[model samples]
Target: MNEIKAMEKPIKFSDPLFVTLVASICCLLWGSAYPFIKLGYSAFDILAEDIPSKFVFAGYRFILAGLLLLFLFRVMSKRKFNLSGKQFSSLILLGVFQTGLQYMFFYVGVANTTGVKGSIMNATTTFFSVVLAHFLYKNDKLSKNKVVGCLLGFIGVVIVNFHSNLLEFSFSLSGEGFVIIAALIFSITAIYAKHLTGSIDVLVITGISLFVGGLALTILGLLLGGRVTHFTLESTGILIYLVLLSSAAFCLWNLLLKYNKVGKVSVYNFLIPVFGALLSALFLGETIMELKNLIALLFVSIGIYMVNRVSSRKFSNTLES
Candidate 1:
């Protein structure tokens, strides 16, 4: 009760420093998920071809994460879990787009493409979020700085994926194509979530949506004969890490969005791909020390700086005016 009251008190959610810290943490946690998920796959002996198994595995992680969050929040806030009919409906929509459909496409798309390519492709979510926010909200109109920052981030993604014959003019609808679709879904749902936060608790919204989406995935996976080869201590630890990541990342992200403009906060998403690629290299023993990687990081860093600098100036001007 005390803690909840303290949180409700004035805080620096709009301050550039606070937003950068929280949003960067959220993106980094999500970025680390790439390596952790890969480790989970290996630990469980889940083959890349076993798409159903991937779904089941993701389902368990998310469901457990959601439950853990709900329990923690209930205890901390000294409140019982309750939801209105409208909140429930909003959560269902969020689950459908943010988790169920997004992951369905992402898992399948990743299975068909190289991990490097997939990570780069997933960064498209940043672009989607910015564009969607511009159209969806009266206050979050598109700006030249936003466009330039996003373009630089996109260019960084491409640079990171640079290699001979990287864009060999061939496309698969279910592979790379589906990954882009997942990005679009995530972006749209993020905007929806921003709206929902106006009426519901952030923790409630995140936990319920995760649980609902995970349940849906679990049912689909079971019907498709998904199964893990092992449930050993190591694999269990990996699963726990994933659960923690999902809980922390989603919760923090929701809170951030609740208090901040989508475009300003969403641009940090570009860093996810940079972190994913670097972490994957560390954990999977893939190559990381490349000229392109360094250049990509530089570009991404600049993009983040540009986006936030413009946003902060606007905020400062608002205060003065």
Candidate 2:
């Protein structure tokens, strides 16, 4: 408590430096999840076709992540769970869509698609987030740059996935289509989370929602005859890493969304695919450092710049005007 009392000041989560550093770290961690999930399948001896096991695996990761986060905040931050009936229901709704259904579709979808295609489809979350924010938030309405930025980032995602024939692009209802649906669900629930954070502690919101969603997934998976049978040292280690990453990433991301314009923060989501592709290459022995990848990186960087660059200049003009 003494250490907590000596805290200097509230962090300026809106500061460009803080936002850039934290948001990038969150995206990088999320990007790493792509390869880690795939590795988890191999390590656990779960075949790609084993959908129920995939659900069980993800359920355990998030259940543990949620508990870890809840304990940390309760102990260190002295956070409480004095939620109203409405607030409690709101959190349950957020968890069901955000953590439970999103991962249910995402795990199955990614398993059936190529890594490149999965990453590309995941980028659609940003698109959905930005567009939804425009309609939902008065302050985060559509802007010229926001549209252009999204398109550029989307183009980059497409480019990175263009490994060979343009005709190679194909979509399956259970594969890429499921990924798109997951992305949409995530975007919609994230905006709802931002709304909840206006009244509730963002960390508490993240923790409770994750655990609630994970519980649902676990129960459903078990009922469907899903079992996590193999628990080797390596697979257990991977699961632990996933839990830690999800806890940290989701906590930080919720804080950012609570403080920043949803569109501004969501635009950085483009980097997930870039980091995903690069990390997948490094860990999975896929191609890397190609000309197209560099081009895609350039496009993505430029898109992020366009969305954020307007803010710095606007701040300056406000001072001078």
Candidate 3:
């Protein structure tokens, strides 16, 4: 009984070690999203022109995720779904941009590009978040080490693409362009989410935004003639996994950002592509032992180490000063 109560205790945000454990779990779950989404595309038979269907699929995933989160929170904490008008409006806005626009762009973008290229491109979210944080928070200003670290991470992403014909420069605005745009959107909204979570419960914000955004996506997809096929037991099971990851990853990520520096937390995003590539190979039966993939992983790991070193030094200096 005492062990159960102890396990249920709240996370200690001030403890950097605990924050890293929680945040890393969130990133790992999100990293798995890349391959799972590709599998979803296959299961649902979502083709390139089936953009609307993608939206519908995402809608189902997130709506259920949101509802599940609400139900779990209610059961665990006995909290109600009470919210003021302002909170409701804020969540609506967060939902529109964060889950709605971000995933809308992501699904479409991934459809048009190779999985390798798409995963690498999507990593720009870290850079975007770091830059945006510098401007948004006085304490989170970009340092020389941060710039070096970000550049190294970006270079790692670029290196991974060298195995392909990246110089073809045939980047479609709707495809790779949308992926980049989605990263920007994610970065911006993450900052806003952190700010909002300062006042509102992370669970409330996550649930409301996911539900509102998901509902909108579902309506828009159906209106645009989008349909989901292959509603078999297997596909339903896959979808349930998606819902689980969405709820768990987003909720935990929001809490991490709320408690820590955005730049410090966001740098771990460099690992997503590494994980994505590895997982894609594992699940999708693609090649995994390529030299480029290993090299890319090394570069990304170093970048993560560099960024954290600087961030840790900064934190220690602040304490001393």
- All-Cα superposition RMSD per candidate: 1.7, 2.4, 3.0
| Ranking of all predicted structures according to TM-score, beginning with the best and ending with the worst | 1, 2, 3
Count the clashes in each prediction.
0, 0, 0
Candidate 2 residues lying further than 4 Å off, grouped into runs, are: 1-11, 316-321
| C-alpha lDDT of residue 205 in model 1 | 84
Q: How many clashes would you count in candidate 3?
A: 0
**lDDT (tens digit, per residue) of candidate 2 on 24-128:** 999899989989998999998878788887888888998999999788768877757789999999999998889999988888898878766887888999999
**lDDT value for candidate 1?**
0.85
> What's the TM-score of every candidate structure?
0.95, 0.92, 0.90
Model 3 misplaced regions, further than 4 Å? 1-11, 314-321
Instruction: Order the candidates by lDDT, highest first.
Output: 2, 1, 3
- Index of the highest-TM-score prediction: 1
Q: Which digits, one per residue and each the tens of the lDDT, describe model 1 over residues 1-321?
A: 687555533246777888899888998899899889989999999988999999999999889988888887798887986788877888988986788889999999988887657777788899889888888889887888888888898888888777665766556878788899999999899889888888787788889888888888888888899986699999999999999999989988888888888999988988887777788888889987878778988998888887778778877887789
Candidate 3 similarity to native, TM-score: 0.90
